[model samples]
Target: MVKYLEAIRKELDYAYQVEMPQMDDWTEIDIQPVIRKLLVRIIGKMIVGNPACRSEEWLHLGEHFTEDFVAASIIMRLLPKWLHPMITNILPQRWRLRKGLQKTRDIVDPAVLRHEEANKKRARGEKVDEEDSMLNWVIDNAGKDQVLKILPEIVLVMFVPAAHTTAMAISNVLFDLCSHPEWAEKLRAEVTDVTNEFGLLGEKLPVRDWTGKLEFLDSFFQESQRMSQPISITPNRYAYEEVIFKDGLRIPKGALVGFVAVHNQIDPEIAPNPEVFDPTRCLRKRQSSPEERDKHLAGQPSKENFAFGYGSQACPGRNYAVAVLKMVLSRMLVDYEFKFKPGDSKPKKYHLMEFIIPDPTATLMMRKRK
Candidate 1:
């Protein structure tokens, strides 16, 4: 994951240095769409073995799949499983999903087949490419014959999570930065200082190198997620035994236990000024011991400051996410100047649907800095 994120950061850096110069001719254009395109492309290349997945087919596949999956998942949850197919089939969503799934299968099938064949050639004393990606790694690790059977499912599982989650997270962070212009200069200062000291941005900076170094940038991302969790609610967990809480509440065995992370994130007791956007909150807490900091941040599972999930189920992809976010934002800050549209006073409101809240559409007019 770290390596893949580094690859993304490198692409972003190239865009900042090489591509931005060409934008001088266009007087006005929406930068967010372009940035989103680049990010999705970089992430697609990382998740799937092919950079071409960012082409129209897979991009359309991503959009359709997200819509259909959300609709299907919600319907299945609200109604009985038996009734779900009937309702879904009646709607246009089912057709969109079928087509999207077919496209996804088409895109991934060839890659999986290629990896399998490569592994076979390697066994027969043929040299294989060293730069082969995650799909190749998974294929090599799993016995070739066994992998050939389960490869498609494995690819699907990896693709959906990475594509949806990474794209949404990037969108949220970009929107937040655009909305809160006050933090821009400070964030830029930090990124500039760090980049000057290290020569390059991205995975080259070790986890320890900037672990807590970019404090304000880290806090800003955390606060953005706190206000707008990627997923509204996490999965439902069935309790095998009774569990007691500090507030004299006992959850009985066989009961469903779930948490509303949003509530915990904004609770007055946890955060002194819950209503205001303050990016400094997490950084201040970081100065203290790990135990104390964890206590302060702990609550019902939420993206509210919990960019990653909680305890045993926390996201393993967090380290990679942080690295990529830092690298991308740092590069953007150093290379461009962003401002809102004229007379567009109010910030764009995040759009919420079921468990997901996507970034609103807004053009961040850009000019290359001297």
Candidate 2:
């Protein structure tokens, strides 16, 4: 999965070279759709492999799956589990999602069969080359019965975590950069200086080599994440057994609990002047002390920084997301200068349940750099 970083870098390069709007006197582009498509293509390639991932129909399905899945999930939670069938039967969005999953099955079924055939050949002492997609990884690692049953859902689920959040994060961070030109200049300089140091400008490098060198860029992303969290709660769980905390607070069996994510992240002790958006806030702490360095990284999750949840179930995809986000930002910094459209301001945020969503309709004025 980590090896896909170079692949993601390639996709980011493609977005810069092809997808981003050509600069001609403050040309405006709605980055939401463009960035979303780029991320979908990248993750689609990572999960489903080539040909299918690049297909226009498949990418379009990937985009709608997120929205439809969320709608169906809400319906499922509201109605009794026994009524799920009837509810899905009635809800148009749920029906669409089911159809999407079916289409996904149609797409991956051949790949799954190929893997099974390979497995049979290997069992007969015949050699077959290893495949790269996550679908193949599941076929090799997960039980055969589970793979057969859950393959379509697995493909759909991969789309859920990677698509919208990544695109929105990219969009919001770009908005933030445009709103704060000083920080944007600093990040551009850092991106330029480091990529030059690594000789990676306009080139794809391995995930490990170049990402670590962009310290300021990392901090800028971390700050953006801190200021604008996607989800409002963290580590939601039901107690299987009665448990007691040190403070004498006890959670009864089957009781639901979740951490107040925003409060923890905004606590003055953990993050000073939390209200102000300082792009270098985390970077300063990272450079301040040895212990704090790892604490502020985008993937590092603690009680205070629970954007990726906590404990064993912490997001496995975050490391990948970190690499991809950095790649996109680095590319944008080098390729374009962006700002709010003429006489337009930053878009206002709105909430859905506990989640905070960025304005997808907003447009940014972009000027290609010489």
What's each prediction's TM-score?
0.80, 0.90
Question: 105-128 in candidate 1: lDDT tens per residue?
Answer: 677777777766776888999988
Candidate 2 residue-pair clash tally: 0
Per-model lDDT: 0.62, 0.79
Measured by lDDT, the strongest candidate is 2
Each prediction's total of clashing residue pairs, residues at least 3 apart in sequence or on different chains, is: 2, 0
Q: Which ten residues in a row have the lowest lDDT in candidate 2?
A: 201-210
In candidate 1, stretches whose alpha carbon ends up further than 4 angstroms from where it belongs are 10-35, 51-55, 75-82, 124-127, 147-150, 202-212, 239-256, 288-305, 345-359
Q: What tens-digit string does per-residue lDDT give for candidate 2 at 1-370?
A: 6876765566656545656677657787878988888888888878887667777767889888898777677667877889876776799897788788888887888777777787889899998874478887877788768677878898887778887888888888898887787777788888878876777833555665687778888788878888888888777888999999999999999998888787876899988888888888878888888887776777888877988889999888888888788777788788788888768776788766667888668888888888
Q: Candidate 2: lDDT of 342?
A: 68
